[model samples]
Target: MCLSFHSFRKLIASVLFLTFFFTGCKNSEKRTVKTEEITFIKEGELSIYKPGTDVPVLNLNIELAETDYETQTGLMYRTSMKENEAMLFIFDDVAMHSFYMKNTEFPLDILFIKEDMTIGSFQENAQPLDEGSLSSKVPVQYVLEVNAGIVAEKGLSIGDSISFQKL
Candidate 1:
């Protein structure tokens, strides 16, 4: 077939554009990732005790958040936690600390613990995904997160104490 030079160049350009477009789309499809749910990892055990008591009021399988990244990402993106499971954040400094639900998917009760292992303050029934600051309102070295309503259910109080051991 006889064709003009300009027409031949236009045909080549169109062919190249379509080829690139389809190839790009196919590559993107292959790159699509299926997100899986994050599961809990047991790292320790914690016990909460009543004031001046030797026996524990509650015991929990805990996931420790000791690193900067672990503390910052605490419970985020998890759908839910078991009633017996909790996340304990260990900070190096004893100072006023605060938390928020942010990307957390379930309600929680946050306990603020002093260096002496006593509960200093707590925020109960923190709403899921709320970005509002849930402050300790006191200096604390540890923060414990558990399923909402656990504090009241366990009869936990400010003077209650905690002891933990890593697995």
Candidate 2:
């Protein structure tokens, strides 16, 4: 069918408007992004030892957080951690480091270890999802995160040492 110039312009404008309207509606639809629950993967085995003792006080299957990304994301999305599991963050330089419980679902015991493999300091029973800074008062080369109350239950103390083997 033949149409006047003004009629054709109106038809084109109407089509354009409807196209944009539908596209906008489609774009505005609510979208839920499914996030997979993170699970614990054992990368090593670590033992906490009493001072000057050959026997270990506690042994754990450890997940090492060595890379920058791994260290930064340490145990953030996990729902729960088993009693025998832990995350050990290894840093290249021995320095005072601080941690927070951001995005973590469960409470934790954070142990700071010095270059000599001795526990330098610790923060026990850190609440979940807390943004408060948990500090290692002394310079440390490693940080160990375990289920909350582990330190107290195991009687872990400053000067306690650790040894680990990668699996």
Candidate 3:
């Protein structure tokens, strides 16, 4: 069929518009994967011992986040942490520490430890994805994040001490 310039241009534009519109709708359709799968992270082990003695209670595989960037992004997108796993945050000075659970996918129990190696405070069973700040009532140099309820399961207390070695 012979067509004029205007009809040809309009046909071409209509075809392009329909192609893009259908393509966009297809991309927006429900995806097969409901949630993004996250990989588990393990870097080392941290042993939590008795309050004052060296007697060991339990050892947790841990991922250490020492630098400023790592500390800021701690466990934000993880789907879960093993019962025997934890994340440790190290800082230079003993100061009040605060934590929030934005983008976190699972609950955690945060342990705040003083420079002298004693547990100074705890934020237990912190809900996942919460932005509320969890605090160390006293100044602390280290912070530990573990699967929620691990502390109570092991009967951990305020004075419990930890010893860790990197893998």
Candidate whose TM-score is highest: 3
Per-model lDDT: 0.95, 0.96, 0.89
Q: What is the lDDT of candidate 3?
A: 0.89
lDDT of 3 by residue, 1-167 (tens): 99999999999999999999999889888556566766556778788888557678988888998999999999998888778878899999889999999999899999999998889999899999999989899999999999999889989999888888887
Evaluate model 2: give its lDDT.
0.96
Q: Which whole-number lDDT from 0 to 100 does residue 135 have in model 3?
A: 87
Total backbone collisions for each predicted model: 0, 0, 0
The C-alpha stretches of model 1 lying farther than 4 A from their native spots are 1-33
Q: Which residue pairs collide in model 2, if any?
A: none
**What's model 2's TM-score?**
0.81
Q: Estimate each model's TM-score.
A: 0.81, 0.81, 0.82
- Worst lDDT 10-window in candidate 2: 25-34
| lDDT: the better of candidates 2 and 3 | 2
Candidate RMSDs in order: 3.4, 4.6, 4.0
lDDT of 2 at 3: 100
Model 1, TM vs. native: 0.81
Instruction: Give stretches of model 3 more than 4 Å off.
Output: 1-20, 28-38
Clashes of 3: 0
